[model samples]
Target: MKPRSTLVRILAMATAAGALAWAVTAGNQPSHAATGPVADAGPGYAVEDYGYPNADKILAEKGILLKCGDGYIVLADCASEQNLLRFLARDRADVCFKVTGEKGYLALELESVHGVRTSDVSTTHLEMTAENDRVTYDIPAKTWEGVGESADGREHTLVEIRTTK
Candidate 1:
């Protein structure tokens, strides 16, 4: 009986010592989680300016200054498709845009614009600058309207276009 009791106490002490050693070793080891601010170099933060994408390249190649927009309206080829909003200018080739979504807006600069053709899906509102005064023209859906220099006798530069369904 005494020998059996002594063996039980020895086994219990060994287990307690093994557990304590394991706990101490684990407590001394460093963890992988971040405990403070790190000074390591990483990828830069992304910032969106929203001015216009590829604006400099487009202006240099095509002589068109597309400043900004909501990305719903985009420039398109005149002969690309039907139902496109088209613009006519005396000094340059015909400029056209494709309108999508429920509404669209674009700010640009086109010189000597004389006419505007609205698409069949939405009404068009155009703003132009003649001398120092601002001129606005509203064209209904699926219609051809005289604007800018053709409407008045002065040369006008198209500045903005807004459309709604």
Candidate 2:
């Protein structure tokens, strides 16, 4: 049999060789796995812009934008808006909101707002656009109004809603 010292030296040399092989191979991995999309230049990181700060993020994840509102007028659940203040869209389902205080405004552009229901107390105005025309309406307070294709048979989008005392 080989001497004890010779055997110990052989084992240590083997271990060192194995470690060197591993270290060399470890650095050769594809850089894509190491840095992900940061390796790209055109659009480094995807940015979802829904107009509001973090509201864009929320809308990106949930397909909804309800975080946009000052305090007086805000997005509300479709079931909770009394079905009185509701909207219908072409590409999307339904979007709703709750308006409070005497005066408020909402800068919303739900694509294809074919239907609407206005509140009772505050006089409201709707800014809308159809195929080739832009129209504005002085909505009667506490009344249901259809401003889009549902009303004029022209596909329209409710770009903005304004209310006042």
- Tens digits of per-residue lDDT for model 2, 1-165: 669989999999999999999999977876665564646645567765434556676577646544344456667677764634567677776777677777776665566677677765777788888777888988777777667777788777676777776
Residue 117 displacement (Å), model 2: 0.9
Q: Which residue ranges in model 2 land beyond 4 Å of their true spot?
A: 1-53, 61-70, 81-84
* lDDT of all predictions: 0.89, 0.70
Q: Model 2 clash pairs? A: 119-142, 120-142
Worst 10 residues of 2 by lDDT: 62-71
**Steric clashes per prediction:** 0, 2
Candidate 1 stretches greater than 4 Å from native:
1-42
TM accuracy, model 2: 0.57
For candidate 1, the 10 contiguous residues with the lowest summed lDDT are: 34-43
